[model samples]
Target: MSFMPPWFWLLLALLFFSALAGWVLQRGLKKQALSADANDVQRQANRRIQQQHLTDLDQALAEGRLSPAQHAMARDDMLRHVLSDATAAQGNGMRPQVNAASAGPVRVVWIVLCLAALSGWSYAQLGAAQTWWPLPLSQRVQITATTPEQLAEQTRAWQQATQSRPADAQAWLTLARLHAAQNQHALAEQALARVLVLAPEHDLWVERAQMKALSAGGVFAGEPWQWIQQVLTAQPLHLNALVLAGSAAWSEKRHDAARAYWQQALGLVPADSDAAQGLQQALAQATEMPKLAEAQASQVVPVLTPTPSGGDTRPLIQGEVRVTPEVQSQIGAGASLFVYAVAEEGSRRPVAIWRSTPTAWPVRFGLSDSMGMGAPPVLSSLAQVRLVARISKTGSAQKQPDDWQVELEGVKTGVQGVVLNITGR
Candidate 1:
């Protein structure tokens, strides 16, 4: 059997003692009443018997049925009986004397003590002593402060909870993300490993790959590359995996491989999507690089944009990105900024995109169809879109804590000079 705490045992003891005291008090009261009633009955009977004898003696004397001496003797005997009866009545009629040891102040003291002990023990057992008791003002202030130590404490609590519930995939994922936000890649990877065991899904693998790449400073080699390949093998058209593959190839200077992967991804991605815009930019950049004449003749690189006509009639969306003074101070040097236009509804792929560093505040940016990822939802094709600008501390397109961004909804195609802000995350 499970053992209860000391307070529980103390509570039980108090209850038992209190109940015993109450029973003793009730029994004493009942016995006292019974004794008093019996004493009253016996006193009344003695008085009645004494009166009858006296009446008989008086009759005998008045009727001259006996001599005066005999009457006197009888009267003396009757007097003796009266005296004896008086003494007996006095002893019996008096109230039962309370035994000092059993029912007087000492017993009362024991009862009171029992009751007080019970009350105190009950309060101790049931009160909020373990949680939320009133704290001093200084202690409350210290508890509410958001210092680094407090953050570490919170992280430890989360770690403990995850340890206790190892099967909770979401919890593991959240812990991993938290570690990543703190730039603790090793710890984050450890948590992610747990997540992989608990929940093996394509999206999670893709996320792990992204994390690995970020840890490598945007290099998509080693385990991160392997993870991407695993996801692609399972799902050939996985959008994120295909995008990462293309990016990895481009980073390695394998332009042909990058072009092939991007082309495949573009076919699967929404035509007028943000992803398509990114892919288009990559493809365009690759095509612009000088090529050997013989290789160029053999391989015809696909061009997303037609040669500029007279004045370049291609549609363009222009915007200015401004950072609030309060937010600007929080942005670290060399942080990356991404500005893109995405369709307002359906797929959230960008129609066009521009990337830069935060060195220039209120930077001017422009995008056209040539910057699109694949081809479908080109900037000129969409009637309305959302223009977004984000300052990413982790150099990631994914939003994280402390990342700042601003957006304008329902912006018409070809709109010029639209202003966006980098507000607090």
Candidate 2:
């Protein structure tokens, strides 16, 4: 049970802010009034000096009414008196803030205001940051849902908001920012992806992509590096992407590559931004790292070889699917996967074909050709792929998947090192 309702808090905040503003205003007014008073004093002093001169000249004329020389001398004396008085007046009156005692109230008000602000900020930091104690626990908590359905509902609301106003890049960015804040890497990735597709010229892609990269790599396990490469191809000066790329590389011990990427990006970003600072630091560290051997070991699936007479292989499986096997099936949370196989140890890569789920032969999970893993595939470019797969994103679903099966086919060339994860009963 609480007596303070929403309006009560609202009123309190309003009053608090109003008091602060009023205090500041009063101080400004006090300063202004002091200036005005000084100006008035100067004006009064000048008026007195002129009066004194007139009085002097009249007295001298009355006493020496007989001689022209004496009258002239008396008039000169009067002029001198008036001029001296006017100078004195100008010096004192023109100096603003002649009344220092009157400003005490204003100064006190400012002090009180500062103390009030400090108190409010302190209260907010302690009570709000941890737990709101003044109100009931139910009302005090900032409600965030935990159930899968609730997440979906919230995600749906965000999606609907963007859909209703497709042109709102800021809304998209806001949603992306929210997702990034929650470490919802998949959602953030989708949001950034939308930004790229909708507004290519938007200045936020590099930044958003950087956030996505960290979120994906740190918690969610998505294709952060690949997406970053895509962003880099489009925008070379993307600050976020560069920082993310460097971080990802350095994290995995690819110091040379990280340094190179950082050096490329350092000049394009704000000097004061954390990313730029990190770039400079990474570049310095990378120079001292001893180069490691090029990574070549990979578990590979087999590829079909073309017939010398241009004839198909004896079995359709020979040409239709790739033979991709991994060194192991188990991997750690942050481990990388590499896949590659050749007919001969030294020969070039082979073509990979696709097969449906529960295939009679080895099958890859994609719509087109290319057997590949992200880690190994990124290392080389001679590989061509025309494969696409529908992967479940963000894996937030609590229920088990219905199918452990997928399909793979070929388009132009086959890729290597990709692993298919399917879970079905």
Candidate 3:
């Protein structure tokens, strides 16, 4: 049912009571008027009877049926009774008092009270009684925030709302989108996690995956890719999921996979819409990227300067990441390749990381100090490093069963040529 405000019901009640009270009072007044008319008719009939008796006495006296004294006494008696009736009729005006209980004002008051009670009871039963009281501050919806101050206030309000009503999945979803809008990907992912627990719809799964990927700097590895896979498995033709999957492939340089996903999604959207136009543009870009890559392939490695600034003259670690033909045949177009270098000792965090799709075998790869994860422990600072290349079956950084991997340990930084053949897991 659609929501109705409290004042609307109250006003409707008042109008109904007014109409009913007017009707009841009118009925009572009409009854009293009918009773008064009946009494007036009876008074008139009594006067007529007294007049006929006086007339008969006069006739009798004229016919010598009675003496003058008798006639005079009878006539005087009749006249006195007629005068008394007139005085009494004059004393009691047009409407005689019928009953105190049947008064118009009393009936109106009773009607008002009864109607008020009935309205209150009916509203309590059929209407939203909570609307009669103010809602809690946290439960109230905030207007769209335009300014930073307003955004902060709205964020706090939504946070309080989620805290107060922890099971409200819609509230959590809204808060997640709000955080996403403000570019707070980590916070958005956290809020989306609540939504996943409370209401794990397919669309929300795609949204959570997107938020998580954004939090991980546009890398759809591990959990994010898993979420996307779950959604695609459930709803193969879901439009938003298709779009997101295409974008994820595009991010991993899987142009063919990206083009396929976008093509499917493009068919679902309206031809003239902005979404369709965007998909078309992405498809066009994906189509041209492979050609560009092939054109620049020969010139790519030779153009790289072999020396470094800071008086360190050492070539970067250049390598070929290859997969066996049998294993390559089993890989899908969307599979991801991770070539990274970590320190020989200490933390396993990659000092340098590069990601791409292994569409072709024996791919040229390069790693240098500049390719580090923008943190401490530069690649050049390490004496020796562990060079690892792996092909993820699920297009994720994390390894799973049946993936292909190869590792080269004790590889010095700035190694001239390295070949890592990804064998079967």
Local accuracy of candidate 1 as per-residue lDDT tens digits, 1-425: 22455557556877777767767886786677678677768768877887887788778888988778998998898889778867776776565544523554456567868696768866767766334244322122112213447556666777887989988776677677666654455566677788889778777787677667655444677998899899999899987778778766755657678788878888987889877776776666556533522343443432221211123255677767888899888888888887777787654445566677757577777776545543345577678888878888877755566788777888888777788877777
Candidate 1 runs further than 4 Å off:
1-164, 170-193, 199-204, 210-223, 230-255, 262-315, 324-336, 346-353, 358-360, 368-383, 392-403, 422-425
Measured on C-alpha atoms, candidate 2 has an lDDT of 0.47
Off by over 4 Å in 3: 1-143, 298-425
User: 212-268 in candidate 3: lDDT tens per residue?
Assistant: 876564678788878887888988998878888877786676879989988999999
TM-score of each: 0.39, 0.30, 0.39
Question: What is the clash count of model 2?
Answer: 19
How far residue 410's Cα lies from its native spot in candidate 2, in Å, is: 52
Task: Give the clashing pairs for model 3.
Answer: none
lDDT, candidate 2, 1-425, per-residue tens: 35455445644875677677766767776777777786777668767876776676667677875366776886777778777865785676554455564765767677666766776777666546224325322122132544437656666776788999987765676666556444355566677677666666424554454555444333213555666677788877766567667666755656678777778888886799865665565565456443211211132322221211112111122222332233123212322211122222111222222222222223333221122111111212323332222212222211114312223333223333444333321
Best by lDDT: 3
lDDT of each: 0.67, 0.47, 0.72
Candidate with best TM-score: 3
